[model samples]
Target chain A: MINSIDLILVLILLAVLLSLGSSRMMALIKIMALQGAMVSLVPIFIEPQARLSNGGILFFQLMLLIKAVLIPGLLYMALNRIAIKREVEPLIGYHASLLVGLGLVMLSAYITRRMGLSLPGDYALLLITAITTTGGGLFLMMSRTKAITQVIGYLMLENGIYLVGTALTKHTHNIYLVEFGVLLDLLAGVMIMGIILHNINRAFDDVDTAYLEQLKD
Target chain B: MLEAVFCLPLFAGLIAFLLPVKLGRGVLVVGALLHLQLTLLAWLSDFPPLLPGYFSTAPAGILVLLVTSFIFVFIAPYSIFYMREQEMQSEPIFIGSMLLFLGTMSMAALAEHPIVFWIAIEATTLVSAPLIFVNRSKKALEATWKYVLICSVGIALALLGFFFITLSMDRAGIDVPLTFSSLNTAAKHLDPLWLKIGFIFVIIGFGTKMGLAPMHTWLPDAHSEAPSPASALLSGALLNCAFLGIFKVHTLMVLAGLGDFSGSLLIGFGLFSILVAGIFILKQPDYKRMLAYSSIENMGVIAFGVGIGGMALYGAMLHLIHHSLLKSSLFLSAGNLLLGFGSKIVAQCGGMTRLLPRTFVSFFAGFLGISGLPPFGVFVSELLILIGAFKAGHPVAGGLFIASLALVVAGFARIVTSMSFGPSRQEILVPEQTLRIVSPFALLLTSAVLCVWMPEPLHQIIINTIAVIGGTIHG
Candidate 1:
């Protein structure tokens, strides 16, 4: 039987795939929230020793709140205000993006296998999931035309990095304060991006970033 | 003392946000003066870090701190005049963000720990985003969006790199602190594979912020679209902070005996940046964008110098100082031109020598200084870098460096000469002001003076900074 950790990792990978295939902004935001919650859970499950500390528990709770609730809530609010229900005229088609997402997962798996890193059991899977999530986020950012989608992409990227941090770092080395700072930065980043998205909508009458081509060389 | 260096700005920024526009501008100037004074005091005498583990002033840190502080003291007053001419609706926010941006950059400069540095660098992006969008124009909005998204993504990767570094320590069973100094001392015992991987990520991440080639798409747009004073800070003070991040990691790579691996990457990115900038500079239409590309080229030079090691590293340090001075001056002068002609298109800015003689002198002088002309510190720095490149036995790289420099100079000459002598366009929108012109002039003068004479303390600091990478003045 697959362990709970492996199950959660697979669920997170599914979230990445769903985000890539989904065209609706609301769906993407929901997928990110789910992914964020899963990413926060990884630390607690992977490092049982970390759960012993009250500070770690409090830090994880804070991370969960921000990553899962605060950031996605901000993006959701942006989506409502902008009223752009879907990412229109994406630079790439959805079918092609889904195919690219599949290729990314396979490539990440190949990399993990070729590196021969002696990670603990199932960590190679964890690494593969994190890499795919990160790559998918970047692809989303590059492929989608809407500014809101790019913000979601950035949040996805941060979530992946958070996973990498959890998978690689030791429990004892994880300082709650530094992690808190990182989370705060991420929250603030998403909020700021949301504000800009609102302004872009106001200025251009839509959230699409194709209008931004005016500044090119 | 270190707390005061950043705290004064933070406190002033809050007040500036609440106050009236005129008072807010006053607070900004006062805060800049106080910040610069604190920076000088910190430089002259060492004090224990207020927060011992998180913050301290290393030689490299102080070098960047000095540049940031010095440039701000000029930019602050110029901004008052600049905002007044524009009559910005969000003057308060602009002033507040400027101060906050200064505070965050100071924090980055003084940060000793990798995570602290990461947070501080990321903070610079958040704080400066408002300054870019303060204009509320469509182009400003685009620039701000791209700036925030690209930089935040880049810095996120840097966080992963930091994790890998921690992983290296875990694998090696080394229990040292995560400070750069400590890490450097323990680097030899760390896992080399993980360390190399970490270095690559850090370089690419911070290199994106540093405007190195292939990752520099955001630089031209953000710099050209932001208000001139904000562009000056972004180009001058902010890029140096990103370089400090890379330089710190490179120090660790050197200590880990992987200097060759990291050095070649820097050299490769640096040369490509120069080539790219050279190619784009040749036919650039917008004057501000041209200067922005020039900033990219100078950054390339600094990176190349550092990567060459030995004497070139010393040259890189000097290039860092001179580039900050000259490029900020150029941006500020470009601001005056923008104000005078009410356009950023180079074609519309002809006969600048006659139209705005005061700005022309500073603008033309700034061009000469940036293009590595004599009587300027950049001349000395570029000469030193070239000599270092040859001394390091990279003759092909040296040749390419020279060729790129020639192309840049040729392109810059054509533009500056045309802007100076070509037929005039529309009438001046806002005539040049003494207050606006003073900042750029002072910066150019500083570069010229430093070229002729090097102060002992500053010279010693440069030596100490480069010594870690095996750099010396005597090639």
Candidate 2:
């Protein structure tokens, strides 16, 4: 039987896959929300003996709220207002993207095997998941044409980084205040992206970033 | 006191947002003055950080803070006239965001801890996005989108790099605070491998925001699309704050005895950015975009100088100061040209000397200063960098540096001559104003003055800033 941490990692991986394969904008947002929840939960389970303080607990809750609820809510609101039904034509096809996602996971696994660092138990899997998630997020950003979809890609990348921070660092260095600052910055960044998406939609009558090509040299 | 230097801007930004447009403009200028005063106090005194682990006024930080504050003082008043000329609808947002951008950049400058520094840099991207989007044009929207998305993604990688550094400490069992000072002291004991990996990501991450090439795709668009005053702040001040992040990490690498590795990386990125900017600047369409590319090239010069170390590191710091002054002045002048010609394309703008003679003077002088002509600080700085590069056994990089500089100057000369003398496309749309003309001239004059006579205090600060990397003015 898989442990709770392993189960969560699997779920997170599954969310990344779903995000890449899903064409519907709302479905991708849901995958991101799931990934956010799993990412925030990783710190709690991965360092069970660290004994989080009251402030640490509160920080995690705030992270959960922002990552899972507030950011996705903003994206959802943007989706409703802009009314873009789907990412109809990606720069890369869905099938090629899935293959790329698989290749990324395999590559991460290979990297983790060769690194030969003395990490805590199960950290190899954590590293692999983080790497795959990051690569997949970047791939999504490059392959998608829609502005909202690109934002989702960015969120995925951010979530992957959050996982790396959790897997690699010791809990002692995890100052609650600093972590909260990072969370707040992420929230503000997403909100700003959402606002820009609204403006992009209104100006061009579509959220497709293809229209943004007019600014080039 | 250091807190006041940043916090005052935050408070003023909020008040500016709430107040009417006219009063908001006053708040911006007042906030800039107060910020400059506070920065002077912070520079002169040794005020402990209110949040001890997070923020401090280090030598490098103070240099950047002084530049940011000084530029804002000029850009603030110039923005008043700019907004009036453009007849901007979101005047309050523009004013508020500019002040807030100042606050965030100041925080990035003052941040001591790695994660705190990352957060502050990321916050700078968020606060400054609206400034790029303030024009509400489709192009502005596109630029804002790229700025926010590219910078956010790049900085996330930086966050990952920060975690890697912490991992190095954890592996080595070093329990010191995560501030740059503490990290430097503990560098020798830390794990070198992870530290190297961390430095690479931090460079790439912060380098993107600093407008270094390969990751510099977002810069020209954002810089050219934003209003002139906002463009001035972005090109002049924001990029330096990002450089401070990379510089602090490079200091750690130096302390860890991995200076050669980090130095080579900087030199590589630096030279490549110069080459890219040089190629693009040739036959560039938009004058604002050309200035933006020039900003990239100057940043490349600084990085190249710092990487060469010894006297070149001193050149890098000098380049940072002079570039900020000259480039912002050029952008401000470009703003005036935009108002007069109603076009950003160089082909559409001609006979600038006859059309807007005062702006032409400032613009021409700014172009000279940025191109490293004599009597400008950039000339002295670039000369030192080349000399230091040769002395440091980087003769090949030094040669390439000169080639790139020549190419840039050649491209820029063609544009300047054509813009100043070529046939006019249309009548001037808006007459040049005294307030608009004064700021760019004043900024160029500041660069010229600093070139001829460096103040003792500022000279000392530059020495202190580069001393960690073995930078000395005298070979």
Root-mean-square deviation of each candidate, in angstroms? 1.5, 1.3
Q: Assess each model's interface with DockQ, reporting 2 decimals per model.
A: 0.83, 0.89
Q: What is the DockQ of candidate 1?
A: 0.83
Q: lDDT tens digits, residues A24-119, model 1?
A: 989988998899899988867775664746667777788889988988899889888986799768899989999999999999999878977777
Candidate 1 segments exceeding 4 Å error: A120-122
For residue B6, what is the lDDT in candidate 1? Answer: 88
TM-scores vs. true structure, each candidate = 0.98, 0.98
lDDT of 2 by residue, A1-217 (tens): 1388888998999888888898999999888888999899888887765736556777778888998999999999999998677999999998888888899999999998888767666577888899899988999999999999999988888888888887777777888888889889989998999899899989988999999987777
- In lDDT terms, which candidate is top? 2
| Candidate 2 RMSD to the real structure | 1.3
Candidate 2 A-chain TM-score:
0.96
Question: Lowest-lDDT window of 10 residues in candidate 1 chain A?
Answer: A47-56
Which residue pairs does candidate 2 place in steric collision?
A: none
**Candidate 2 residue-wise lDDT, B83-181, digit = tens:** 898989999999999999999999999999999889989999998998999889888998999899999989898888888889889989999989999
Q: Which stretches of candidate 2 lie over 4 Å from their true place?
A: none
Q: Residue A178 of model 1: what lDDT?
A: 76
Q: Report candidate 1's interface RMSD in Å.
A: 0.8
The residue pairs in collision within model 1 are none
What is each predicted model's overall lDDT from 0 to 1?
0.90, 0.91
